[model samples]
Target: MDLQQLRYVVAVAETRNFTRAAERCLVVQSSLSHRIANLERELGVKLFARSSRRVELTSAGEAFLVGARECLTAADRAVADAAAATGVVRGTLAVGVIVTTAAVDVPEVLQRYRARHPDVRVLLRAGGSDELAAAVRRGDLDIAFLGLPEGARPPGVETLALDRDEHVLVVPTGHRLAGAARVTLLDIADETFVDFVAGTPARAQSDQAFAAAGLARDVAYEAGVAELITRLVARDLGVALLPSAFVRPLAAGDPELALVPVADGPRRVEYLAWGRFNPSPATRAMLDVLGVRGADPED
Candidate 1:
């Protein structure tokens, strides 16, 4: 019925527990319970089915949640728009990134953005490129940095290609293939590899290349982080094909690791993606900080 009641309902739904929701909302448990009870009585429908162990959203609640979130988003955006008119930006900016991205220095960019707009709250999340792109499309993220295979763009959003570079083969210093001038996929076809998880965009870069070469590799280990993959390679557990930008600095730091050029390697493209529709002022400011003023949200 009111914004307060809606907030309480959303909080409870997200936390799935009354006590935690109350704590998150910075309200006492009894007060939050009373407000939700009043709202249910007014609507003549139970929004939640409450049990001692957990609180579950009922069918009616599920339907209400969709509109409730939209209403809250609109309200917040209205306030932010009003503030923007007075030369101030105030809103939450949710950014998603992949762990292996090396095109843009994320922390430094965030620090600069924070310095310019201290009023805007920033939330950062780490995920696979595909997952982060989906979050941006779903309005869960305001912007995202993704590292996808060459020529593959994330669908349903506006994107800007940041960087494109080929992959390199990483090996342990003592390995036979280390210090090689250059190696092709055929050279490493029989060697065990440590690579990103199968089906991920990061993994696809190498997978597509090997498939095109008519070669199959044995991936001995699957790790999400590039650093972990490099660690496994350093121990001589396996060799890996990684983005040149990410592997270069890593090999420089670790004496046990060596970088070998891949003559026929897959290329990875880094992208900056955001929603195509009306962007919040905070999103615009972030784009400006990234040197993309009036960035076209179109492909």
Candidate 2:
């Protein structure tokens, strides 16, 4: 009923646990639970299904959370507007990034952005392009770095192309093609493949390339993170196609992993994407500090 109770509901919905949500909200577990219980009693609907193992949102919780998030977003915007009137920028800048940005200069940009606006807190989230872009579209994230095909980006999002990197073939050092000067999709078509889970930008681009070359690939295993894919390759489980900047840097640490040029493989463009009318003051400041180039996305 109250704003604080709504905040508690939103936090618990996001974290899926009372203790962790209470910690994030800077309150004790019992107090947060008491507030939520009071709200549930007043509403006369169960928000969450409590279990010893995990918490799941009930039907009412799912419906309540959507409105709760919008209310909080509106309140946040009002507070930000008032702060801006006094030339004060203080808020959280929620950012998302794909795994490959480990090679990019994101840290430098964030450090510099914080130097200019010390009161703004930066929170980073990591996921594949599809997940991160979805979060940006839903206003869960203010901005994100993602690998995407050049053709289409998500709706309600503006994009700034940062850099494009080619995909490379990853093989264990002992694989015969590891020493080859050039490799093609045809050469690896029949080999067992290790790939990212479906819907990731890397997987999409790789699939496109294989299809364009008129070949079918056998994906033997799928992993969520780059490290797992490389480890599978190193163990000779299967070969994989990955971003050059993402898997290439592992050469120094993993001597068994060999990164080879994919010889005209697909190139994935990295982008900084945000809501078209994103109004976060800290987000605007971060954009200025990064000086990332942008143009209106084609519909």
- Highest-TM-score candidate: 1
My TM-score estimates for the predictions, one after another, are: 0.96, 0.85
Q: Rate the local accuracy (lDDT) of all candidates.
A: 0.93, 0.84
- Per-residue error (Å), model 2, residue 105: 2.4
1-299 per-residue lDDT for model 1 (tens digits): 88888899999999999999999999999999999999999999999999889799999999999999999989889999999999999999999999988999999999999999999999999989999999999999999999988889999988998888999999999999887999999999999999999999999999999999999999989999999999999888999999999789878889999989999999988999988888899999999999877756443
lDDT of 2 by residue, 172-272 (tens): 99999989887888888999999988766768888888888888889989888888888889999999888788776687688898877878687787888
**How many residue pairs clash per model?**
0, 0
Tell me how candidate 1 scores on lDDT: 0.93
Q: What is candidate 2's TM-score against the reference?
A: 0.85
Which candidate number would show the highest lDDT if scored against the true structure?
1
